[model samples]
Target: MAAPSPTDHKNRKLLGRLSLPESRFIADALRAETVGGVLLLVAAIAALLWANIPAISDSYASVRSFHIGPASLGLDLSLQHWAADGLLAVFFFVAGIELKRELVAGDLRDPRAAALPVIAALCGMAAPALVYALVNVAGDGSMDGWAVPTATDIAFALAVLAVIGTSLPSALRAFLLTLAVVDDLFAILIIAVFFTSEIDFLALGGALVGLALFWFLLRRGVRGWYIYVPLALAVWGLMYNSGVHATIAGVAMGLMLRCTRREGERTSPGEHIEHLVRPVSAGLAVPLFALFSAGVSLSDEAIAQVFTRPETLGVVLGLVVGKAVGIFGGTWLAARFTKAELNEDLAWPDVLAVATLAGIGFTVSLLIGELAFAGDATLADEVKAAVLFGSLIAAVIACVLLKLRDRRYRALTEAEERDEDRDGIPDIYEEGNPEYHLRMAKIYEDRAAEHRRRAQKAAAAALQSAAGSTTEADRPA
Candidate 1:
């Protein structure tokens, strides 16, 4: 190339330093959340319209109540029940895989980083529950639905953020995601403990045995769908018969899968399965469940009754007001007590707006509603209305708050670009003069020291592992 031009050589150097592209699997999963949220919304709307219109309400009811499974195995259930108890298991399975990945190698793998979201999730769940309980005090069975507002729907909340929070800091999204994951774990626990009626240990034992086999197969690198599918279905059936919310089986299987990559393995089985299953869960399972569960009769009488009931009011208020207060309050308290500072790129206002977005508890809230009022169709309808209404209100308020924050963030970015000296320091920070530059220099030095320490630790670990492997290789084998 004729002793490459100076500009061309510089471009080649810069290109060499660039990072590799991100895995497409992860990008697709994130994008699927937004698409799934829209599809879920559409399904809920379609169900509502079908249930409300006088011409098709009866037909909608007929289709929902229709049964078609084998009764000999206690598997015969209404279409709605199948959607809730069966299809939802797929969604939970993907959630379980994601949870395992997070616990193993993701943000939650670090204790200090995980603590903020764990505390926030616990507080987020508790506040909504307490608000529901306080509202339903002295009521007969209304207190049974206390867990209704305790969930934060990850896909729905993320969709809202994706739509209106383009300018928000990445840290805010990370906080929200971690908080929601923890909340889902708690919600699963609630379902297993509170919602389950009569547990048959024999069936549960069978499910456990099947799960053990599934785990063994997975660890051995047995990736055949035919082998795993039958085992999974058997486990689901046994759990369903055991009355432990068949979905728990999915969670159990997900958590049991080996997350670490073997020496010769291209990817961990957890990641492989998650990549394959997440699309089905997001596109089909969740929307199907929503279509069935969200078909509440939105009549004038139903609307009046929904507002009149303490249970409905409790759910609405708990989700709207309680989620915001709990998440924000918990974050503040954690940072205060632990002496951990918030990210410099984010503000308290951004955290508050994120907390509001946490209130959009759609998927799990609806599931809890169905469980809370299993036999009583009238009460179930009321709970559905409350969930829809509350989530909608939360979405609107979150959009407004995020839009304002987006404007402020854009202004901040513009101000930072106004730096004249090209010293890489924002004008606002530069106003403090020499002391600011000295502090910046100290920060750079500290960061460099930390990087060196990490590199040394990693090298030592690799050396030790290699030595151990060499010793084993030289042994009897």
Candidate 2:
């Protein structure tokens, strides 16, 4: 075999080390998602207990089935539908904003940096659907649920990482985030394309007009929650009535938002909106959706059906086996064929662990399962059980692998900290010498000087305005 060139070596590495800002951002995002994941888990558990405990199970069903909203506009839907169709739109909206930010400004802006994750995400999704389809075909079952195992729930995956991979490289988290973001985009496309039953052209046209108005107002710098809220509600309603999944409206609006900040602005409009709405989505919307959607009856028969039913069985195997193989194999193939290589800090084992973690497809998987078997309530419940069981198995396996990796990394870090050179300084602190500190100090000093100049300029302008006002008053007297 020929030796790889330096440029090839540089370009080929997967999960390369992240920049400080990017690392910090990932950490913050992981923390937030960890909380959301916990909430989702709690809600799912509560729902299961409520639905299976004979005394309260009927009430749970009744609450989930109760209808609400206006009937005149075809807006009346059961509480479960509201959680699935309405609140999930908020979750997808946040997802769309993150996707936009990443594509426009984050690591995804560079095609080279994006290629690996993009390929992995594509393969990750494809493999699951393929697995599901093959299983269903062999068993003579329906193919509608092929997409059920295709999604990777970011909240659950990140939460698992946060808990088990503290000493692992930040690059792993970045890779997972990028992969999940691309996964979300593909999932949205799938829902919008395959799930629609019919199109109400007029209503769809009205929705498009509303979206255009939204873009126009945002571009024109029109600001006010009152105006945009009503407009957004109208757009969502029109979209729902158009025979399209209403969540598409949220994704559309999120993509349209400006992701870059203007001069003097601390954050972009998309960032600000995500910050404001993320809490609502995480704390309320998603948990409520889980509460309503995850209330599957876990009877002994239901449990057996999850394994025996071809469609449901496909969901289980797809998530537990297919996701791991697809992601790991895709990344390896990309590196083997292309100039890219595995990141020096990460090993094939780490990638495998992360890939396994990706199999916890909780939220979107459930949504697709419901959509796939909408008419067969029994089948849908069985599918839900399968998803829960599969995700649990995947989570446990990932947790074990990640914990092992974390221990190794922790030991490596400790070893690095203990080793010292002849100069009596630890090798780990060599890069943090006085020279590096001096350079950082210089940078801070220059920023401080620039801030002082701006402050003086503003003060001078204020003083000049006050003098002009005094002169005008004196002259008038």
Candidate 3:
């Protein structure tokens, strides 16, 4: 790597002056996601170590299998179940909010623009599932996990891309984000429809009523946690009893929140909530679940079984081979069928790299694996092994591909970042157009003037309030 120039060091110092939220946007949320992925990976690694070590494995197993919660309410679940069903609800809630925002007002709102990712996501899901089913067709009930490898863990994939593809195209990042969002929506639906069994209509109805009341409260601008918290729990519990995954309740409630900005708010309530809770979900909830869920013992016998079993092989192949072919081929087919061209900034090779990265199906993949082989502990462990193996392979392949194209990507990133006038627009766009530069400058000036006006108005209000207080004091005297 080249040594940093003096200008680069100065730029870093300048960036240090930005506030936390400002730094987040400047870093484009990539840093946060990457950090979260690192934490999650660490937690999973810790779990694997704890489960494999003879001294620690017993304690690990005991803690994971221990029951908790109110038994009377049929809510007494193992620690692993709590991690999978309870904590992951928070993660899904944030996903729901993002999905709603995208559908209502973001990129997915436009049909033509959304077509590419939506189509790619659908095919990306279908191909892996088909592959898994084919691979396990002769196996005994292992085909139940066909959906296991279909998911794309956005954080893990993004983290890998962040570390290796620092100079990758922004368009490719956006495409991956959109595709993953859609992929998650599909995964949720699959869980709801295929995984759920024996629904209790009474509890389901109660959940519906609670969700309705929650939506009403939100519409009435009731932002009180006291009001929402108990109601949310009620909905989640009801959904749990109703035999649907309780996490779906979170998604439902998130979708219910208003996505468009309301009067006097800088951003929508949904966006605000997501911004507040995403750190909790990414940093704590998901990582904790990973720790609880990823504790597979990789004993010699288990390792041999993982290779020998058709189901385990299916998951591995589905994630590593199925995902790459599905994602890349899906994108190609989507573009061809829609008569849409790839983003001008993204090449087919870049798409291939991203598709390979998408194969890192860690979080949701494990969850599905657990649910799929819930009847047999041995199969469940095998599934976990397969997921870890497959995801690691995917990460390795993606790293190599991304590194191969790193130089081209680096040059592109540099050109994009070059802004000689420092007007918030890349210099390339403003190079030939003095008028465009002036227009941008005027916009910034007008925004500054508006801020000044708001500040003056606030000062005047403070002065009036002070005078009124003085008058009240004189009257009392």
- Return the top candidate by TM-score: 2
- Angstrom error of the Cα, residue 322, model 2: value is 0.5
Superposed Cα deviation of residue 165, candidate 2 (Å): 6.9
The weakest ten consecutive residues by lDDT in model 2 span 1-10
Q: Candidate 3 on 121-218: residue-level lDDT in tens?
A: 88888888888898888675467889998999988877776666455555565567778899999999999999998899999999999999998898
lDDT of 2 at 360: 97
lDDT of 1 by residue, 1-477 (tens): 001011211222100111111112233345677788777778888998988899999998999999989998889999998998899999889888778876876556656656678989999999999998988884443787899999998788766766664544334555666687789899999999999989899998998899889988877767789999999999999999998999999999889876666688777778777778877988899988988889887778877876678999889888999999999999889878976665555578788888888999989999999999988878988998998888888888888888877877676546544555556545454665887777667877888999999999999999999999999999995
Who is ahead in lDDT, 1 or 2?
A: 2
Instruction: Give the TM-score (vs. native) of candidate 1.
Output: 0.80
Model 3 error, position 111 (Å): 0.7
List of clashing residue pairs for candidate 2: 12-340, 12-341, 13-341
Ranking by TM-score: 2, 3, 1
- lDDT at residue 51 of model 3 (Cα atoms): 91
- Model 2 per-residue lDDT tens digits across residues 147-230: 999999988876666666455556677788889999999999999999999999999999999999999999999999999989
Candidate 2 regions off by >4 Å? 1-12, 162-167, 411-434, 437-477
TM-score of 3: 0.84
Clashes of each: 0, 3, 0
lDDT of 1: 0.79
User: Which clashing pairs does model 3 show?
Assistant: none
Candidate 2 C-alpha error for residue 115, in Å: 0.3
**lDDT of each model, Cα atoms only?**
0.79, 0.85, 0.80
